[model samples]
Every structure is written in structure tokens, then in C-alpha cells.
Target chain A: MLDVTKAKIIHDFAHDRPLLACRYDPKERFVVTSSEDYRLQKFSLPGGEKTILPEAHNSWVHALGLSPDGQILYSGGCDGKLVFWNIADAEVKPLRTLDAHQGWLRTLSVSPDGSLVATGGNDKTVKVWNTQTGELVKQWQGHAKNVYSVQFMPDGKRILSGDLGGAVQLRSLDADDIKGNFEAKPLHTYEGGQMVDFGGVRCLAVRPSSDQFAAGGLHKATNPLGAVHEPLALRFAFEGNQLLKSHVSEGITGGGLWRVQWLSDGTLMGVSGGSSGGFLIFWNDQQDKDFSKFKLPALARDMDLSTNGLNVVTAHHDGHVRITRLSES
Target chain B: MKCPYACGSTEHLMARRKFLSLSASGAVGVAGGLGLLTRGAAAEQVQQKQQRIVVFNMHGGLSQLESWDPKPGTRTGGPFRAIPTSVPGLHISELLPYTAQQMHHLCLFRGVNTSEDDHGKGAYMMMTGRRQTPAADYPEIGAVAAKTLMPEDSSLPGHIRVVPHGGGGRGSDAAYLGPKYSSIHLGNGNPPQYTKRPDGITDEAERRRQEFRRKSDRRFLDGRRTAMTDVFTYSFEQADRLMEQRDVFDVTKEPTQDQEKYGTHDFGRHCLLARRLIERGISFVQVSHSNYDTHNENFDFHLEQVGEFDRPFATFVADLAERGLLDQTLIVVLSEFGRTPNINLYLGRDHWSKAWSVLAGGAKLARGAVLGATNAEGTEVVDIQVDHAQLFHTYLQAVGVDTSASFQIDGRELPIADPSAEPIWTAIA
Candidate 1:
């Protein structure tokens, strides 16, 4: 079980601007964060040593994806530019920058083999890039609105993309025999909730076994303007893209889940907050109820879990990177 | 005298004289004679090319940082950036890219100090140009324009409000100016009820029915001379005039290309209708865009709301300019107030009134002009602060109304604007 009764903040690092995206190095020795100040910084875990890479993007850097080998990182910003970074050096170095999208890039996902990087953007297109060569591999146009999140299934031949209209589509990455060229075919689609018109799926997590995936976002807008709704986390069986279950934090007043992740032991976690406050909630497969939850000082924009699953770090709108510890089973 | 409708027949004049004789009374006799005299006066007013006003009321407070005045890169600026407009140094939020292209036609006021924060009170103050008082009711700007600028023989109601979602708050009434100047509220892109003749009724039959009803109503109203009775009598006459030219409210009369340019959303259609009404010589047209409260998820909701607003508004302005109405029509974009500059814990902004922004253009108002300034954090006005009364006076002046005039309400002279306030002269030509 996930225990938050003994949860404690391990470290808190401040940046010049709100940190929007974060990723943990494969060895778990460092954490790289992107911020609205257009800078990316690397912080050494435990020691808290910070190295800032100036001018990382022309505008707010919103999405960060790290290679499986931890040797390279990809950053996408509102300037519509996507850049590849070589993080093996003492300082992060830009390998190449590609004018990827026509609008703000919201989410990025790397294939399991690290050969392809999938990007979702405000242009309403899902684009795959050759990570090493910095070339455009494929682009799929199916989302009716801004594409918010994309993820590669563990099998690495299929992708899941979500949009502002709350549509989740499973697409094939391989070329069809009749087409003779790589064209993403929509395999399945899941409509999140009646409130899908109010918001889109913001974060998606595929299980380690690739048999199930969870999508998180707001379930409804209580008012016409404010997104004061229940933060919803839906778990779906991959076989048919069937919705198996849904979870929400009881008594939580306001906010929508901005990020979701599945722990190695199958604990599903969601981070969300709005004007009332922020929350970090965890749910296990055995029950629909949240097993544990911790409140944060500010809204958590994004989060990354360490490989061992003992530590989870969150980037916040208040310019603080909060590190918290989970009880070991 | 020539008939206003130019039907080249004396039948309309005979009908007017007959209606006047039926309702003639000691109290209404003077009003009837003055009304006839004003018809000639109205021709003179029209000869001067009477200016018109269109108030785009953003019902709930819109965020100044997201629309007119942006403090990008600040802690409270959210994720959107500020982009340069056609004006050299003026910058507005990137969310309004389409409006930005039309900046040369707009004058932005970023330093407004409306002290009331509550929705009802703020709306009252902004609409009536005066603080709430227990002594007397105040006239809204639309009502004032209806009384002061509309041609006496206008077939359409001078003051009209197109409320799509619903009414925002109080203060749309004519108050002391009486119900005759009150706004004619229309539903979401639909014509006012009873406008169309019933399926089985012929035009001549309908006219005969109206004449019979008017004769009975005049008899019933002969001794009952109250404000309520006057309002009822006025409504009947207005409805009769409206039936003759109801096509002005038919937005479908516009071509498909024009409709597509304004977009298909309710707000867009309302704007297109506002343009049509203005073209038909409406004195004041208030089109309200609802639900900008945005107490949480400010940036996300703004992207949706502003994205929907930008294209239609920009297109409307451009169309007005292309049709040569820009010089004679005054366009006002306003809200009750603005949202707080402090980004709340919910990632939203609460209601704020101390410092905000409003956009005005046309009627020879200074173009490409940005007046006033807010502090670095947008928490307070730093330069040339304008209050609700001053802004209202400026609007009146832009539309060629005498801001210094007063209305004789209940035997007391009430100033059109706040007595102590002056127009923002720098904003007007």
C-alpha cells in the first residue's frame, strides 16, 4: 500500500520562474526542469546543485522528454520550436533545434526504444520525429482541437494521443500494406466524460505491462467559466481501449488533475490543484478510494517519479520543486 | 410634411393622426405635440450625421492582463505573451492576435479606477455613470442615448440589448428616464415574440385587428394616466412600428460569407446582428458576451473565451470601416471591471476593480492611442487614472452627445454624467 502518513518533503529548490516540466535521469542522480523563463536547469539529487542552461527556448518551455538511456533530452516550448539536448556533458548542450509546430507545444513523449519522439501541440497535430537525426518522421491530423498529451504504448508500435476536446485515440505507428507509406491509422478512441467539452485529457500513463493506461483531467466545469470540477483519473484496458474504472479524490473542492503516473507496483497517482489548493493523491487497484493524499502549497504543474518509486518530485507554479518521500512497502 | 417611410401616401399620416385623437388627453396632449415637432428636429439631427454607439458588454469582468493591458513575464501574467500591434509601442495579449491587427482603429484605456467590485454594483456604476443612491434612479448610457440621439420617427427601438445567455446584472433599466427609453431585450439570435403574423392571419386582417385593439386600449387608458399605463401604450406603438421593418433583426438576411466571417458561435451571431442594427440607425446597441468570471483555470478558460471573441470582434470592426460607418459609429468594449492581477491558488483570478482596461474607437476618437498606465504588477493604476464617470463622459463626447447636459427627472435636474467628473479629453478628437 502507498503510505502518506509519514510523507515528508525531502528537498525544495526554487527557480526564477514557474517550473512547468521535469524529468528524472535514468540513474536518479539528477533532475532536469523546464521553466517559463525560457531556461532549463539540471539539479543534482540529494546535493541540490543547480546548473542553468540559459536561452533553452525562445518562449515558455512546457514539455520535456528524456531518452531512455538518459544521454539526451527533448524540450518543446510555446515558440513552436523543439530542440534536442545532449545532457551527458557538464552543461546541457543543444544538439539541434527544429521548427516543429505552428503553435504552442504542450506535451512530448519518447518511444520505448528511444527511436521516435511524439509531440502534441496547439496546432492540433500529433507529430513524430527521428530523435537522433532531428527529422520529421510522421505527422497525424485527427484531433478536432488542440492536442494536449501523447504517449507511446509499451509495445512501441502504437501511440495514444489526447486532445482539448477530451478525445483519446490509439493510432498505429507502422505503415499499412495498402498505403505503402507510414500513415497513422486510428485504432480506437475513448471519449472521457460529459464534461469533455470543458477540458481535454492533460496526462496519460501506460502501465508497465502495456495492458492498461490511465488518462487524467477535469471531469466537469461547475460554472460556465471556472473549471471547478472533480479531478478524474480513468483507467482503461488496452485490449479494446475499454474504460475499466475511474477515480476521484473525495471532498476535494476544486481543480483538475494535470498529471498522472502509475507506480511500478500498480499504484495510480494524480497531481492536481486550482484556486482552492493542490493535492497529490494515490489509488491502488484493489479499491476505488484514494489510499493516500498530500496537500501542496501551490498547484503542481507536472511531476516525475523516481525509478525506485520511493521518491516523487513535482514542479509547481510557485517556482518550487517539491520532493516528497513515499513509504516503502 | 413628407412621410418618414416614403411610401408616397398620406395613409401613415392619417393613421398617426387618428391614433393621436383616440389617446388625446390633458397630460399627453403636450407630449404628442412635442413628439410631432421633434420629428422635424430629428431630420436636422440626422443631417448633422448623428453619431451612434455600440457597447460590447463583457458581462463578468475580463482580465486586463489577458486582453487590453498585459504585464507579460510578471508572476501574475500567466502563460500568454504580449505581442506588438499595428501601433508602434502598444502591445496587447497574444490571444487577441486578430484584434491586434486592427489596433490602429482603437484607443485603449488601461488605467481605470472603478472602486466598486461587486458585480451588481459595478455594473450599475459602469452602465449609469453614477454611484448608487437611495434618492433617485439613474439612466443607463443606452437609455440616455435613446432619449437624446434617436430619430423621433425611428421604426426600431432606439435602445436594444441582445442578451444571448441571460441578463448579467441590474442597471439596464431606464430608471428615471422612464420605460420608453428602456432597452428592448431580444433572446439568443431570435426575434422578439409576437413579431411575426400568425400562420392564418393575413396582413390586412392583422392590421384591422391591431386597429381594433388600439381603439379599445385607448378607451381603457383614457382615465388611467399612470407611468405603467404610459409604458403599456408606448410598447403597443413601438410594436406596431417594429412590425413594418422587422427584417432588420433577421441576421439570416446576411450572406453566408459574412456569417462565416463573424463565426457561427452565439456571441459571433450577436455581433453580426449588432452590426445590422447599427446599420439600420439604432441609437445604441448593447451586445453582451457572457461568463468571463474565470475564478479558476484563468489561462485555459481565457484561451477559449478570448479565442472565440477575437475573430468576430475584429471582423466586425473591419466591416464597419469598409462600409464607411467607422467614422459615425462609436464602438465601446467594456466590462464591469477586471480580474485580480494576483494569480490565486486555483490558478484563476478573482474580481478586481481598482485598475482595469477598456477599448473605444470610431466617431473620430483618437486612433492608435493608448492612454494611462498600470503598475508593473498591474495591481494599481500608475498614470492618468480614469474612473467610471470620466469614461462614460468620454463615451458621450465621442458620440457627439452633450456631456454637460442634464435630464429633468421628477422635477430635479440630474446631470447626464457625474456632476464632478469630466470627460477624458485626450481620448476624444
Candidate 2:
């Protein structure tokens, strides 16, 4: 009898350690997480009150990006560093730490006119930088492993990344061009499973209005490191980039799909649970029905659809910082 | 032959007593001289400094009438009452007066039995000590201690999961230890900015771009090698030792009188950043404190959830025993199965997994006392029972690990604590 109602725990940041990647703040009123205790915090959304940037970064802060003019914030760490914060006065300082990569910066992409950023690491290289001049503007270096999702393609001159060999590559923010048009790609590529068998291409989203995208795999060398043969994909994009309708959502027999979003009325919201009852679902706009679910209290990793679309922040794996409420009807 | 020249000051005092009898007969040969400064002050008064597991996940199950198997004056013990603690026969539930003044460092474990009363298989059998596989997928003991203690090199992150969302059954993994032994998830820890350094960038261009990416990664590894050459040379030496200790996640360099004794909450600044990430060595950290799937009001919702766990858990166990760090830190509260020794009809309690309770104290557990028991109709475990592989071998023998170790998988040889249950070693200490 509860579709989604009790909202008032606001922000329970417990983490003796288990919060991996979370982002929000294009006005969802602050929420940023990434840990294994190397730190990167900032929470206020719906009054969870926490503001200790802890000097922003040094390690383990893997992937974060908010600058669509939310006044800068881009992190990506595990000491391949790369920080760029300034969320206004609560500043823990770090306009640039760019250790640039030898490994572990894993994925970040910002450029819907925030003036370029891009990043991807475990050092197979994919940087771009320049967020209004902290420099290091171009460097793509064809992935051979470790790139794990990057995206800019809302047409800021293309860029999509996804590696560790599941291949998604697209590049070209031009520095006199450096190879990576690998032919109008990732309109769809879900061959994840075996080939070194660790399952890569973990996440990718793109659908604020619709070119209709979504990708998530994760199964890094089995036993359960985020397993997935195909946990979620959606595709869509018509007219020459081809790939009209692709859908894929029923294979969730036990925790796998890392993340996938798309809700602006085009509706697609997501969150795949694990350890058995991790729901959140949403889907409408007929992506094959099933328009509701809420049960979660664990493992909901990365969700955001609130520039006032009636909040939905989420970033879990037991760090519990939810917001919920996309629609009741 | 010595007798012939014997007069040179008695052969230089018999060669200075044979060089002081060969330096006291090589006393275990310089075991690092002076016994390594008295074994580094006897491992600094018995090696402690690494203990972190702040779970507290009361996610959706809260009634033994109100807390701790209470049966009160019976009729299925609804209204709540039972008080008294600090240890004498451990009473509990005057709606937990600050956990009855820290019940002598809590142990509880009121005999929890299980059958998965659904919250998705009872929160995936209480955060993955195991059960819920349909083919692979088992990695949640904080993703197996973030795949056994996170430091394969350490750019910090051998397992961290604050505000975690899914770490139970299908996937909350680092399972066969990939995704580089996963876990570094914070999608939310109040506002640690998803892990920080998103914009203000200035530790001198983050230490001159980490000394220009360690001189362009030593000139691009001067002649590469692949298959992730030892995971890219141990992730570039843990990304240059996590870019020179990124100020150990700087809680504003602490001391606003220790952030007002960690109680302004967001789970008390994630338990004071999990005691500064286990005093900076990070082996496994898991600050969950979630929704507690409460089915209904259930005694004014546990009198405001047991006063939000009695003052941030008695100020995070007296701030880890005033920084000596609670005998190596273990903490644990736990919940995903407990509630309803009958109360329902809408007052709510529901999901009872046979018997329920789990409190656990710091690292070397077995402290003070209490192991298992239940009866007086709390439901089951009539005596000693403990499951979840004996609570993951009593949390791997309270940290000294070695639950028979092993690992290999898919070709056999498992162990790493699962040897089909054993470690209740009376709760180990």
C-alpha cells in the first residue's frame, strides 16, 4: 500500500564505507558522493545537511561531474586525480589537480557548453579538459582497456567513450583531430559478457528529450563484480545514426544493471536492485509498460531527474541519500 | 698455541672476552637491533589501528514490540517497556534510552533465525553473508570487504560504501574480485560531493598535476606491457599514492571541537568519516543506516527510531573509545530481519526472520558478553543458534581473519570464511 511516500530521513550519510559515485546539482540543491573514504562530499538536498568537501580529492573519488552551470564540480579519482570544484564558498579548494592518469579516473564527461571536460582512465587515456582553462585540452588515445563510460554527445562536437573492450568510442572535440570517429558509433553495442569475460561498458545514459540511449553492463571478471549479460539497454536514435528501437530490460534475475536514466516526460527512470529487493523502475511512455515500483533500501546507484521534474536524486549502495517522487499518477 | 704468547695483557683480555661472547651469541641475530626498538614499542601496545564496519542499517524491520525482543507485560507485548542495561541481564527497550546507556558496549544477538520474510529476500539475507544466488552473484559483506581490504596498492579505496543502495543479493558485488574489487560507492554520503574535488581545484594545481602525472607515467611506462601489466603497475602506484594523501579526506582538517562531537548528523558526518577512514589505512568501511522497512507506525515508530540510535551511537562509541579506536572498531547494529513477535493488525511489525537482534561491538568483539538466546516468545533460536555463516565467522574472527583463507573459485578451493560455518568462537576477542 505504499507506492512511495515517507520522505524524512533526509540524509543519513553513514558510510563506515560503501558509497560509490553519485551526482546531482544542476539545482537539485546539492548531493554529491564518492567514497571508500578518500572523500568528496556535499549534501543538502531536502535538508540532509552535510558539507565537508574535505579538500575535495586525492583518491578513490571515482567519477562526478555537475557543471551545466551548477557552478563547477568535476571529480574522478583513485589518484589518477582530476578535480575541479568551487561549489561556492563551501569550497575545499581544487580548481585543478589533473594528475591526468596512469589509471583509475574511470569516467567523466561535461560539455553541454560548460566548455569541455571529458576524462576516462585506468590510463588507457581519453582526456580533454579545459573547463575554462585549467588546460590539457585534447588527448584521446584509442582504448585498449579501462575507459569505462564518457559522454558529451548532445553535439558539442561528439564524444562518447566506453571501454575495457566493449567498445563505444566516438571522439573529436578537435585539436586538429586525433582519430576516433570510429564510424558514427555506440548507437548501440551490448556484447558485454565474455572476451576476457569480465563484462565491461558499465553505464551510459543520454535522454533528456530523446536520441533515446542507455547502456549498462558491468561484470568484471565474474564471481559477481557487478554482473550482467545485458542488464539494461534502450537505444532508439533514428535518421542516419540509425538504430530505431532496441529495448531490453527483463534479465534482472539477481542484481546486475548498474544504472540508466531518461525521464523528462519521455519517461524512463531506472535503478536495478540486488540482494533481491532493490526496485525503482518507472518506464512509461510505453518502453514496454510497467510504470511503477519503489521498495528500495539498498543498492540503487546513480539516479537524477530533477531540475524541478519533481525530484528523484538517489545514489545508493547503502549510503542512503534518496529523494524520490517522480509521479504518483 | 695461545699459551706460548699469553702475556700481551692476557691476550688482550682474552680478546675482550671473545668479543663479548660473540655479541651475546647473536641474540636471534639483530632481529632488527635492540629487538626493533622493543618491537616498535610492542607493536605500539598491541597493534590496533584498523577496524571499521559501522553498518547500523535498520532498514525496515523494527519490532520485538519496539526494540530488543521485548515481551513486556505480554498480550504480545505491544506498548513497550523493559529498560535497564549498562549490562546487568541486558533489558533494552524503554524505547532504548540511548541504547540503555551503551549496554556495556552492546552484543545483543537475540537469536535471529531466518526464512526471508521478503524485503527482497530479507535484504538479501542480511547484506550478503550469503544466499540469493541463482547463478553467481554473492559479494556483500561490503562487497566482500571491498574484495578483501581494498589496498592492492591503495590510491585509497579498499572498500567504502556510505549511503549504499544495493549490496545484498543479485549485485552489491566486487564478487570474484573484479571492477578492481569494487565498492568505492558514495553516490551519497550527505554531501561529500560524491567524493569531492569537483571544481575548486588548487592544491597547487593539485600538486602540479601530480607532478605532471608522474612524469607522464614514467614516459608512458618506457616500453609498455599489457593485460594490465599488474593492473597497470598497481594502478600507477595507487595513482601516485593517491595523489599524495589527498589530505586524508580532510574533514575540514577536523577540530571544530571534533565537529561538535559528530552529532550534527548525516549519520554524524558518516560516523566522523568512518573514524577518518579507519585512521587512514582503509581496509573496509560501510556506513549504511537506511530506511528500516517499517511496515507501519509500530510504537510511534520506535520512539523516533530509538532516539536515532542513542546519540549517534553513544557518540560513535565514545568517539571510538576516545581515539584509541574501540579495540580496533567493528560497530555493526544491523537489521533486515526482525520485527513481529506479533503486533500487527496495522500497529505493524511483520517481517520476523525467526528471532532477531545483532549489535556487535568493536573489532576484537566478544567484549563484555551476550551471544545468542531467545524465548519468552520472541519467536525462535531457543538457545545458541547464529547463522549467516556464523555471522561471517564472527566477522572473520574479529579481524585477525584466517577463517581458513582460500579463494580460487570456478576450479574449486573457496574458504575465505565460508567453510560452511564455524567462527562463533564464542564471538572471538
Candidate 3:
């Protein structure tokens, strides 16, 4: 068994405000953090040297996506603008800007080939853009609420988008349309009877093999406004959109999981927190038992896995970026 | 001096007391020119005019940051941005896009410092314009409007509440203003209960039954006078009147195009019903939108609730203007308080009353006026802090009520508004 409790925080980068989104470069030598201070900072791993993009976005940046090659960075902000940046030799350069969304852009996902980027936004839209050209390729509108998370399937032929109403849609990319315009079909939805009106699917992770995906968010909604609720992860089979299994972290209750990631070894991890504090939970599909969990210092807003698959970095609401080592027992 | 309406006998004294109670209720001279000696000539003139008030109560403390007083780009501003409205240089939250377009008919009060915080207490304070007190129960603004502005000859209930059962805070009772002024509670988007005859009961049979009951009640009250019995008698009469005009509460009578414009949700339908009831001469209508107490996922819930509220409210306001009722109707958008500017660990906002906002307009209120101001973080009132009582006073004043007038209850006279409070003069035309 791998014990996360023994994981040590190797480095902590502090900012003036909460860091909302973060990404690890493919080389695993650089990390980019987006903050509420409206700046994006690129920090050299291990060295702690930082390069700041002061005017990265007009408002708070909530989402960031790194190209498959890791040379390009894309950020979406509350200003409804998406900007592309080129990171080379520990320096940041502004490349292009797309006034794509009408409202706050929530999440961004880049294709494996780095040809396209899909964005989910508060405007209830899932938009696809050409990664190289800053042009909006396709706009799909089926979600009745804010689309919180979007991910491109490993095959790159389909995109999965989840919304605040606990609805998920699988949209197939049209090969014939050069503009990337495609129809979105309802693939799967899971309300879990947890007040679909309030909570949503916050995070989605696709397996490396592209056979299945896991979604993490709140279930078992409560009253008194913000009272503790269970954080859940539902794993679905990619082909049939069948719900294969659900893993709920027992005894760890409060807010919904904000981020979910599938480790190279097929282990699933989720980070969540509420009034009490933050928590890191781990689950393996083969195990029928409870998840292994660890407490954190603050609410985790975003997380990224190192390219080496040995360390996990989390951006916290307390303005600390925590890097934790992961190893097998 | 002997009472002109009654002789100097014990029964006559009781009858005179009833007249005093009627005058104290503020309903006696609402439509007539019967000027009481206690009322100033100007106050009498104000009371003689017919006006209406419709309070759109966002039940949970709506975040000021997401509505009327947006501080976009601030650290505490959350994920939403500010959008410019019809009034140049004035911006509200982007979530209220529809309301933004109708800002010319609204006056925004961004610096309300109501000190109460708990749901029940805060709701009481906002509804009554006074803090919760064990000493006495004060009437809500709707009840006061019903008592002071409702025409005596009008068949419709003066104060109508469109809310889900057990919603709308502690229920808008008349309190000391007496039962006659209490709100006629209607189900959310549905008519008041029992307004229609029972399934098996014919209308003729129902009328005959009511007539028989009135005769029996008269005999039961033979030569005896009590406020409790009078309330019962008044309730029966009001029920009869409501039954006669039940169609006023039927929103289905509205055209499908109009209903579609309202968006078809419960809150939307309730707003549509409110407009219909107001058109039928109801003096005060309160429509409540629920589930704004978003301590968890504040942004998501606000997007849903505010989105649900925006279009219908804008459509309602615009519809009133097109019907020429805007000049006579005062529209109020309020809540018990506001949510905290500081997003909590759950990414939600908690109850915050230290600084908040309320929106009022129409009935000749200054259009495109943004009164008062909050600090950049929206944490405190930096200028022209208006409290609950002051807001209540403004609502009454906007609808042509005399704030200086007093309501006499139990021989104790009380000013209609808190004496220490004053209306926001900048908001008044």
C-alpha cells in the first residue's frame, strides 16, 4: 500500500492572493501558477526562481492548460479572455489572445496532439479553439448551467464536458468541418440525488489507456447552507458511458472534490475541502475498501501531477503551492 | 366631546373605539378625503392618492457583490464581472444582465448597514423595518401598505403574498395593525387555498352556506363586541370577496407569449401573478424567490437563482411601464441582508449584514440614481449608510405614504416609520 501520509512537501511558493490554477510543464522543470492577484507566475522547479506575467489577464485567472509539447500555455480568466503564452528558458512571452467567452471561463483542456483546446465557461458554453491560431473553431451549447469542467478523450476524437447541474455530455469532433463545429450528444449524467441544483461535477480525469474516466464532486447535499457533504468519484466506462463504480471517501466530509487526477499506475486521487479544512484522498479501482485520505492546511483550488509521476502540486486558497511526493509502498 | 358616529353610551364607546381602531389601522381615509384631526393637511393629500407596492424579496441574503453593488476585479469579487447598465457609469454584476438593461427605472442603494444577521431575525427586521422586539410585534411593510393605501371599496385583498407555504420568512402578518391588514397568502404560482368552491359544492350552495354562517355568527355575537370576534367576521367577509374575484389570481389567463416571457419557473410564475394581482388593484404584493442562502457553491447557486430572477423581473418591470402602472407602482428588490464579500472555504458566501444593498424604483423615484456607496471590498458602508428602517421609510415615501403619520394601537401612538430614520432624499424624485 502506498501511504500518502508519509508524503513530504518539498517546496512552497507563496503569493499575495489565492492561487486558483496551476500546471506542470512536460519537462517537469517548470510550474505555472495563476493567482487572484491577476498574475501568472512561472517558477523553476527546485530552484524556486520565478518569472511573472503581470498582465496575464484583466481579471482573476481560473483555468490554465499546457500544450502537449509544454512549450505553450493557455489561460482563461474572469475577464472572459483567453490568452496564449510561450514559456521558453524559464521566461514567459505573450503569444495571442482570444476574446472567446462572454463570461468567466472556468476550465480548459487541450487535445493530446495539441491541435485544439476545449473551454468550459460560466456562459453555459463549451467552445473549441484552434491551439495554434486563437480562433474559435466550434461553439456547442447544451448545458443548462455553468460548464465547470471539460476534457478531451485520449483518442482526441471526442470531448467530455460536465456542468453545474451534474450533467455530462460527450461531443464528437467532426472530421469534415475544418472549423471544428460539431453536435454535442448527452452521453451520461449522474445526479446521485445530491441536490443537482446546487453541486456539480467539478473535475474529470481520463485514464491513460482511454478506456474509462473518473469524475469527482459533491454528493449528499445538505442544508443550513454549506453544511458538510460527501465528496464522491464516479468512474465510467468510455465506450458505453456506463457507470462502472463509485468511490466515496468515508468519514471525510465537507465540500466537494475540486480536482481529480489518474496516476500512471491507475490510482485515482482527489482533493477537496470546506469549513473544516482540505483533504487529499486516494482510491484504486481494484480495492473495495475505503479511500486513504490526508488532511491539508487549506482548501485546494487546483492540482497538477508532475510529468515524472512522482510528485503532486496543489494550489491552495491560503496562497501556498504545496508539492507532495508520491511513491509506492 | 360626544363621538359624532355614536351616542355617549357604553356600546357607543365600544363603537367609537372601533372607529378609532379603523383610523389607527390607516385604512379609514385611504380612498376618501376624511381628514382626521391628527393628520396634517399635506399628509391627508398624500394618503388620498392611490398607489401600490410590489416587494420582490430575495429570501436568502443575496450577495451585493453579485447584484446591485458589484466590485468586480477586487480580491473578494468572486468569479463574476461588472457590466454597465442603462445608466452610464453605473455597473451591476454581469449575472444580472436583464436587470442591468432596466437600470433606468431603478435606484440602487449600495450602502445598507442593517445590523441583524440571523435568518429569522434579519428577515423580521427587513420586513418590519424594526429589530425583533419582545415588547411588541410590528407590522411588515406590506401590511402597512395594505392598511394605509388599499382602497376600502376594492374587492381584491389589499396585501397579497405569492410564496411557497412556510416560505417568505416568518410570514407577513399584520402584527399590531390587526388581522384585517394581514397578507392573503397565496401558494407559489397558485391561488389562495379554498378560494374556489369545493369539488362537490356548487357555487349556489356555497353562497347559501356562507349566508347561513353569517346569520349564525351575527346571533352568536348578539350585543357583544370583541376584537377577536370582529376579526373572525372580517375574515369571512374577505373570503367572500376573494372568492368572487378568484380569477385575478389565475395566471393561466395570461397569454402564452406573456407567460413565455416570464420564463415559466416558480419564481417567474409568481412574478407574473404579482403583476396580474397588482393590475387588479391589490395594494401590496410580495413575491419571494428562494434558495439564495448559498453558503456552498455561492457562484453556481447565484447564477441559477439570479438568472431565474433577472429576465422575469425585468419583464415584469417593463410590462408595468407599458401598462402605465409604473407611475403608480413602487417596485422593491430586497433581501434580509447580503452574503459576505469574503468567499468561505467552501467557495461560498455566508450571511453578512454589516454592509449590503436594496433596489427601489418607479412611482416617481429618481431614475438612474445610485444612492450611497460601499467601500471597494464591499465590507462597510463608507457613505450615506441606510438601515432597514430608513429603507422601509423610503419605500413608504416613494409610494406617497406620509412617514410622519402615526398608527394608534392600544392607545399608544407610533410613527409609521422609525423616528430616527429618514428617507433617502436622493432616491426620491
> Candidate 3 has what TM-score?
0.90
Encode model 3's per-residue lDDT on A1-329: one tens digit a residue.
34465666778888777777888888787888987667898878887677788585777788898988789889988788888988755457678888878778889999989999999898899899998777788888878878888989898878888887677777887732222221112212332222226557788888889888877776666552555576778888766667777777767666567789987768888887665577778888876334577677788878888877778888888888877777643
- lDDT of the candidates, in the order given: 0.77, 0.59, 0.77
lDDT score of residue B60 within candidate 2: 63
Candidate 1 local accuracy as lDDT? 0.77
Q: Estimate the TM-score of every prediction.
A: 0.89, 0.24, 0.90
Q: Can you list the residue pairs that collide in candidate 1?
A: A274-B346, A275-B345, A275-B346
**Model 2 TM-score on a 0 to 1 scale:** 0.24
Alpha carbon lDDT at B90, candidate 3: 95
Docking class of 1: acceptable
**Local error of candidate 3 at residue B278 (angstroms):** 1.1
User: RMSD to native for every prediction?
Assistant: 6.1, 27.8, 4.9
Q: Candidate 2 residues A1-329, lDDT tens each?
A: 12333322234555434466777787667777774446667787566677757654544565888888678888887557788888644655676676878646877878888888888886677888888777887887777766777877777776777764566666567654443422213222322221012335656666755355555543312322122223344454523444443344454444444566665556555666554435566555455533455556776656655565656666665666676665453
Q: Per-residue CA lDDT of candidate 3, range B141-257, in tens?
A: 887887777775666667888874432212438776666677877866677777677789887888799779867876776666355555566667667776777888899998999
Evaluate residue B324 in candidate 3 and report its C-alpha lDDT on the 0 to 100 scale: 88
TM-score of chain A of each: 0.89, 0.32, 0.88
Better by lDDT, candidate 2 or 1: 1
Counted clashes in each candidate structure = 3, 89, 0
Best by DockQ: 3
List model 1 lDDT by residue over A1-329, tens digit each: 44655666788888877677788877787888987567888888888788888575767788998888888989998778899988757867888899999768889999989999999898999999998788888888877788888988888877888877667878887742111111111211222221114557888898888878888876645552554666778787766556677777787767677889987678898888664567888887766678788888777878888777878888888878888887744
lDDT of 1 by residue, B221-275 (tens): 5664334544566677777766667788889898899999999888889999999
